[model samples]
Target: MPDLFHPQMMGYLESLVPQRHEVMLEMEARAREIGFPIIGIAGGQFLYQIARMMKATRIFELGSGYGYSTAWFARAVRENGGGVVHHVVWDEKLSSQAKDYLGRLGYSDIVQFHVAEAVETLKATEERFDLIFNDIDKVGYPASIPVIKERLRPGGVLLVDNMFLHGSIFDPANTSEAVQAIRTTTKLLTQDPQFISSLIPIRDGIMLSYYVP
Candidate 1:
């Protein structure tokens, strides 16, 4: 929650790109107006770049809200002729909103909506992903680690948002379930021999993990 970058730099970042769907733009405006972070444009842009660099053919997202980030990932995956994006949202209202928003963005075909818990939904789907993004319930992040690891295809990438939880992961006394989950997942990625992990200092901090084959 602290200012990782200066206001001038943030403004500079926002000025670099301007193309987005009308609905995506409106939803972003609403998030801004309501003082919600909801994946800043800079953050979305960065995520798109990551997906591109990884040459992601298929992607999965946990806790997609309003489809802003989903649209970015969709665009990145589209270059591969076409790809599937599964968005697991726990709230029906938010999931419906995201579905309608994505429909407006002309991405309903590439995106699928599942209004259910992420872990449970993952159990039923046999789909493997080239890239996975997790921004699910913070309290359940640790529990989802095994599930996420199980779902990631070999050599696939796992990108986790809100790793710092506003810098709470470092505090031993921080009692939030989400913070603890972040810490636990970070520890796994850090010590795992088959993966390379980095804590990216972009917007609330994102963790990028690459599986080694």
Candidate 2:
């Protein structure tokens, strides 16, 4: 499979995003340094836009890494008259790092940190969310769908990252567990009667699904 995005095009898209907070910039740098995969500038901006457009007050993020995407959601939640954004990741060290970064960003009140398996944590949570963002390990994507659907309120939105798997999804020969899971998850979302879905070709690909039921 070829690259889904040209280098220059991705750079242009990133450049269009307005300046982020210093903490966010630092987090981006850290991701780059550590080869950590936080959603890039364009993806983060898009997430913020979706949350703002929907006026999503309550957001739950699966696989929040050092709170980069969580910051974006927390910002929108704060602007939408203050709400909560749950940040869940299995790594305690990453969760601690996220807490420090979000605390510095002054989103400590709006963001809740959790160190546990993201899907289980979301399933255990009692409050229905207005928006749910999933960026967990691709192999887990299919299994996570049922829980995500149950957790989201009617008319809520689900934003899923890495839908393209860097264009491997288009290659018939590529049938790894992660790729297969992505395909199955895509099928589940797009073919389901309860949701209207579109795959947006952002940095990687983000599936934006609106739940109608």
Candidate 3:
């Protein structure tokens, strides 16, 4: 993807973030080494701040990867007087890695891991959540909205990542299914009366939607 933010600006923003735990730093290093995508410092810190600000206790993440983002939410939940964060990803190995990492981070008590299709797991889950974070494949974005709406309590928040698709969403010629799905999801969140939404251009663009129900 092209530079979403100028290199200097991105570096400046990253430099401003306070130091993180050694484990979290290790997770960042691992992502860089493998070219794996995590939310990065800015996005992870944003999630942490939002969860803390809202005093969210019950959080569900649709595409948690090795618990980098999950650790942030877990920390917030811990400071918010304790609650649960559901970490749902389809990969068993990723889930296992997350279990180990979060356990080392002392968040084993705060997070629940699931190795299943994320949207389907959310739909099957009976309990409503105070916050839901969606970072699943872009093609699944549109279909996941109704399920997210149903699972998130009224006044709860929904954070969807990759809304920019590494700048692909802005290209009219890129009518790929993933891009179109993101477009449709954007319209669903912004145009729907039930949601109050804004696209935050941090990292890859996260769609923050408040479900008014």
Candidate 4:
């Protein structure tokens, strides 16, 4: 991923936050060593703050890679009346690993891991969510907009990662499917009256949409 902030700025920003748990530190190291795309400290902290601000109870994650981002949401949910976080992922091995890490973090009981396609899982579920986090395949972004909007309760939040598509979104000639999907989905959220959206430039980028209806 490109550098979203200068090194000095990031150092200063990181200095302001409290230290993370030992399990989180391990996850961060593992992600770096394995070339995994776990949401880093900035993104995790942003999601944690947003979830807490919304007082999110029932949270759903479209894609959870080793439960790094899910951990942040799990903590917030635990502090806010103790609700559940349903994390959907495709790989069974990754799910198992995430379960173990979350268990170490004392969030195993609050997080339910589903090994399946995220959209399919969302379709099969009857429950609604107070907050929905999207980090699924970029191709699914366009298809996921309506589903996310539908699943989120009124005044709920729909937070998406990788809005910048690694900086390819700004190129008019970059007509790759992933970039196009992100563009279409972002347009859908930005133009829709039911949502108020903002794309914060941190890490790859974060698209936060608040459901008003």
Model 1 C-alpha lDDT per residue in residues 1-213, reported as the tens digit of each score:
986567587568767867877787898898989786577787898888988888887898988886778988988888767878888887888888888888877788899899988778876778778888988877777777788778889899988889878878778888776777778888988788877999887778888899876
**Residues 32-55, candidate 3, lDDT per residue (tens digit)?**
999999998989999999999999
Per-candidate clash tally:
0, 0, 0, 0
* Over 4 Å off, model 3: 1-5
How many pairs of residues collide in model 1?
0
On residues 80-147, what C-alpha lDDT tens digit does candidate 4 reach at each position? 97989998899999899999999999998899889999988887889889999999999989998888
**Which segments of candidate 1 are over 4 A away from where they belong?**
1-7
For each candidate, what TM-score against the reference? 0.90, 0.96, 0.96, 0.95
Output the TM-score of candidate 2: 0.96
Lowest lDDT 10-residue stretch of candidate 1: 3-12
